[model samples]
Target chain A: MTGVAALPGTATLAEIGEQAVIATLTAGLPPAADVLVGPGDDGAVLEVAGPLVTSLDVLVENVHFKLGWSDPADIGRKAVAVNVADLEAMGARATAVVLGFSAPPHLQLRFVRELTAGLHAECAAAGVSLVGGDVTRSRDLTLSVTVLGGLEGRPPVLRSGARPGDVVALRGRTGWAAAGLAVLSRGFRSPRAVVEAQRVPQVPYGEGAAAAQAGATAMVDVSDGLLADLGHVASASGVVVDLRRDAFEVPEPLQAVSAATGADPYDLLLTGGEDHALAATFAAGAVPEGWRVVGEVRAVGPDAGAGVLVDGRTWPAAAGFDHFGAAR
Target chain B: MTGVAALPGTATLAEIGEQAVIATLTAGLPPAADVLVGPGDDGAVLEVAGPLVTSLDVLVENVHFKLGWSDPADIGRKAVAVNVADLEAMGARATAVVLGFSAPPHLQLRFVRELTAGLHAECAAAGVSLVGGDVTRSRDLTLSVTVLGGLEGRPPVLRSGARPGDVVALRGRTGWAAAGLAVLSRGFRSPRAVVEAQRVPQVPYGEGAAAAQAGATAMVDVSDGLLADLGHVASASGVVVDLRRDAFEVPEPLQAVSAATGADPYDLLLTGGEDHALAATFAAGAVPEGWRVVGEVRAVGPDAGAGVLVDGRTWPAAAGFDHFGAAR
Candidate 1:
């Protein structure tokens, strides 16, 4: 890393070489009690307990993100947030993460260092150890991250555990990122609040454990919109979910963006994605503080009824963020 | 899954969409006892104990493999083999694997299915579970795999543990993949052994624990050729490694390919990479069956000496496997 740290300001990744780039990225990454062996080895070793919860996510250039609109740090932070959000949904404590990054060799050395800084920052905020990673070259800038969680002997709250009488609750903001995206898409960058949310999600960190302790029956991460994600719960639980549209008060930023973009506030709140809020179901009396009831679970009708309904009526829209979009 | 299965065999990935493609890939995947909850949830839950050893590897379209040179299945197998080899080097039992796959939407549906089938086949061979994965779109076909391993309460073999009197041993073939690569580079694909080795490394299964039980001091995966990988061990352990030229007898396939290609077999053995053999350091008397001694470790003294040498002389070639190649 001495070689990379001493290079000129305009140095590219190709100029410093892969070893130097990797060394620079991993240098001074703080060690954690959970990580027995960190980066620079064939593998990382972590102290573990009970069950392991793990998930994978990939962010591709021009697909999941655009370099023109966001800084590399923002993208790095969002990567950790998205994966940690999944672990939170499963009622597991975020433990550690390993990343695989690939980009064209023409990428700048400073951007690589900044990305790792962002990763370290987010992992620390999430109470996770940045245990290990790999770097390589690709035609597009891409990140593949895997988050590992530990249950600490508690049962994982799955989407299939919702009962007919459970109350649906949400712990964090929804559709704010979507609003931010709408604003950015319209070529406007003001309203810094929503735009910042789009760059880095304000995930409700410890609320997952709190919800689990409060005897929540099921949980989900609101990544694919409130309706779309809750639909997974309804389908998996074999129940009907009915949301109160009045419960969702569109934020001022969203309203402003909606007004300017000619987009529907309700549509953004119900169907926009990447907000990364935690959604869960609990007994009516068991809904804890900080979690507000937005809907109720009901038994499925004989016709198998509907999955997720708004105000007990079908809401017609594309389910959520379909990766293929109109290509399908 | 039914949507994906019912589509025309000639259909591209864009036609079936991400969800359907995911379903098709994960459909009917055999559940392992270690995987308490397999795919479809926010993450896979695995039953675990002791420390967790994990590693990540990324393979890009042209950087790691070429579509014209190999089948999608071979690429898939190689991806799993490469990551699992890292675990084997650490004296850990390979437990589970999670994949992040991305490719252009116009890619054929059959290739995705075949790739997954290959992943499953390799995981089974390695006694690892294909527990979870994510699907996305990128300009280049890419696979990022994270392998999870368990130490089962055994001390991990680290690269820094080799001592001056330790004997260097190897448990799998060296330079076969390189020989295969050389044959393929010349547009000659005969001599199926070496060619297949390039396409799918036959990683020695379960050798990590075998070496560990026999009191191996240090270990490394030979993904970066014998001499280069041993260099890591030498530098980490502050020792000088000297390999016997006569100790390494080139295999028939590699010899044949080397002769036809007019490439130096010694260079292939010393610098050509991606064979994925497990190299370990053990006391001279502790080298176990199925393991063959290749070199000996000597204490670093005086001018601090060279890291790795062949027959007590400096090896003049560049180490191995720079992803940026001449672009650097």
Candidate 2:
């Protein structure tokens, strides 16, 4: 069967109407078991288990995304990707998501449908369902996604759990999305691989579970860049995390983009954000498979102010994605 | 203790900035039990039991609200209230809420804090806590709230369960909010009474559970006018819901606004929305206390589509709140 019409090639969110977008986005999603009712109702019910890990994220037009650069589907996927990454950082697996979308009335029904399809696709990949949401009229395009996750039998891994001697490890590729963003900003058509990464980040979805099973002490995602996120962990855990630059190998995909854009690969690795890779601290023994050791947690001292170090010196990168910061 | 700072009368959302808004919004709010981690985290872990009921709703500046008329705290409270109402409509009690906000980065921090205070106040009223959320920069102000609820010891009530001969009842005020809205539109601002109702429509929090315990065959909340929401139940159940207009009395508050606005009180009774009132079908007998009997469910006629009727005639009101319809 022909796949549902792809999202409009040039449709801005302002072009697709909100209700049509909702109907489109919800078309083919699987219903979660506890959902006595799904979309198109006053509300949705999800099957709850163990303790729930819930989070919410909102993306506004031009703030979280640019209509000129991202397609509706890409916007949808990015919305789910970032929220799901938060669940992963908490050592939880996302089971369901509810969305609230607001847009001008003139937006096309087709674009909304395609955006929902993209959301469903991403949810499927993450082993979750787009369960419930609300659609309303607004002056600007806004997307709000709330994710619910299950801890199963494991305790949640918090940012404050790292011990002084714990080894810091990462379970997914970092810096690639940041590098892709650099290419996009410079008006360069990203290569197929870079564009794919930029549109829908490849997160190590089940790795949070793996890390939890292997007794991860602390975990955070690289949505705010490695050093910045680690700094949060350091502050919360009262430890200093030192990263060996030599150990932070750039993924091949990012290296190519860096060469093409003539951007400093190291800056992309340390300062660029939105990679959504999982970074965690584990005990100083064997780490989980598919994870690379990059640093060690040290006791806070005179030279360290509960922060991160690069090589043997304190690394100074602006603390990640501040909403009001000039760069953002 | 000193109360939270009042918002300056002339400050716009664009002038208040994002982080300052977040800091302001979160100040002085107490946390709930399920919230292992609150705001300032990648995601919050909320303890869930049985199944989780989750939903999201977003309000945009200039479309959903006007800064010239309403305060940020009013907007924040409304955002949380509506989402919590959704959960309640599903026969669930809210446990936590996560907020996603976007605005320009020039507004004062105090205004944002007051908004957060309002959000927390509403969450407290609903027996839930403010957990994790995201903030970002946007050209317009937007508030997105995702609420997580617990469906303790009961299956969720759906719209499809009403049978012929079931009696219909309502558990909260229906026309007050709409009446308040009419008052506001006519520039009749009595901030102490009419305008406050429009800003925050009081919802009967435990009434959903009361209705559920009293054996409601089907249920919904009147967020989209009485006739329209009943139409959903009728269509879903393949039955006819006939209302006795004579039996429905407009409350005093609504009547006062109707007198002031020179609007039809009946229009507010039948077509007005956003009262957050719970409406349900019960088996023919004594319904719960605090609930007023309003209608009866009947088998659909051969020529009549399963729908709603008033005063022995088909109700002639527009279907409620279409996102693509003209803005209010």
Candidate 3:
């Protein structure tokens, strides 16, 4: 090895080129079998049986999570969790994941290892494995996760399949994660529930496939607030969704946290995000186990044109998060 | 939309969270068939027939390419090309690609658009589609591409399959990309051959599968220098490879650039990278149509551990580019 002076662990990524940095990051990791090709190739291939569902998500440091607040492992878990939620939304089970990580050169190798370990833990929880990934040195920390899922011969539940008179239901908590964010952003001391929720989201993981098997017409994961995500189904399916706030009430834990944080319970219920809850429209009848009816889907009307209404009023907040928003 | 003061087409990515940035990037792109679910879910699902192959690579700004030297389109093409070449190395046909992009807030939207366009163009060239992707705000530019491929019933060629008496052959030009980098580093004006080669690499796309069908024992892509990549085959297959320098001649266009740049042509031929060419070892006999025999794989000897030799001398250059090298 050349006797180049090694910089401290805080060196900026700009000092190194991307390729050279990646080579260092992946120097001696064990390889997996499904990964026919690993990091150095143009793409990776895994041997698998059945139909594949794929999803991709990107995470930037500070923007996605403050390093001061979250450890590297937390960041890794969150990244994997969110992407796995996408597969759940498609009514599929995650089988494998591929990661793309970009960080500055000064970042510690231990941090990356811990982060990868976190990813592996989450993958194990989801009954999948990390097949392949890439690492490059960048100006800051950024992670992109792509997950593949398998639908064991079941038809995929799409957002565009809700029909008039369908009963809308949710299978998991809808606003706890957003409430947790609100608490954290306000600089409150660590509370077990809020802190745990913030670090790693709890998605009702297997409920998506359960919902699909139970004859759910359309489904989505509540990632960007309930009203906002429902609006996507409404617009796609050309239907109006009317949600009953009382029926889809905020649970006791979330209400207590909202009260403590001086946050609007209604805002958390209607407009909060990162819940990873499974929300679906089912044919009117008995809802599946672990699911509760929360609303109804109707034909589009002048007052509600492919939109969502909470307790007879249009949601006041902007429809979820947009990347190029003025705040950026 | 909130009437926040807009920075004049010069927004930095740091200001936006990774998720919001990705939302903006994927706002209006149409997805193809294999993309059962697009960017928003936990993961995107892609349709596949038979066994699947996946590969990933990450490119950080400044490290992979100088942003000042390369426009967004060039960066995009390189990212896709490198990942696609990995799939080709497996003798599989690329089917879809998912991208993860992170950049600071000050990045131009036009740059992102151009980058996307370039990705699409490369995908088109490879007869694959840009199925889905994620974009987010970051402190620096980071691109991570994951590619999936389909192998229609053929067994994948592996690095550990070469044996004694196997003939080592090459299917495409080697070292042109490394030569191009030399030209660029010297601040030379764009020459047709050097500039074009740098922008997009030309890998023998379908030859990996062709070589496999022709009963090749082992295969790898020449993304790192030919000698370094071949070393992987040597070590994995427990064989020693002896390359005949007389047989490893430089192509005409590359020779012209080497002469003009005052660089040693031999260095380009042996130690250069980013060519994405296919190098494989076949059982000695007739090679495939587009392949040329360059050496022979010999049994490992007590004195010589599994490695590569050039023209009867052990190659002294360090094996291929490592991301964390002192030069980086």
Best by lDDT: 1
Q: What lDDT does the true structure give each of the candidates?
A: 0.86, 0.78, 0.75
Comparing 1 and 3 on lDDT, the stronger one: 1
Q: Tens digits of per-residue lDDT for model 3 on A182-233?
A: 7778786345576667677887788888888888888888877888789889
- Residue pairs clashing in model 1 are none
Compared with the real two-chain complex, what DockQ does model 3 have?
Answer: 0.40
Query: How far in Å is the alpha carbon of A134 misplaced in model 3?
Result: 1.5
* Best by the DockQ measure: 1
Error of 2 at A82 (Å): 1.3
* DockQ for all candidate structures vs. native: 0.74, 0.56, 0.40
The segments of candidate 1 whose C-alpha lies over 4 angstroms from its true place after superposition are: A1-3, A303-306, A326-328, B303-306, B326-328
Q: Write the residue-wise lDDT of candidate 3 on B121-181 in tens digits.
A: 7777777767667766565677888888887788777788899899999998787888778
Candidate 2 runs further than 4 Å off? A1-20, A31-34, A256-262, A326-328, B1-21, B256-262, B326-328
Interface RMSD of 3: 4.3
User: Could you give candidate 1's per-residue lDDT for residues B87-137 as a string of tens digits?
Assistant: 999999999999998988888878988888898899989999888888888
Ranking by TM-score: 1, 2, 3
Error of 3 at A80 (Å): 1.6
List the candidate numbers ranked by DockQ, top first: 1, 2, 3
Per-residue lDDT for B200 in model 1?
89
RMSD of each: 1.5, 3.7, 4.8
- Candidate number with greatest TM-score: 1
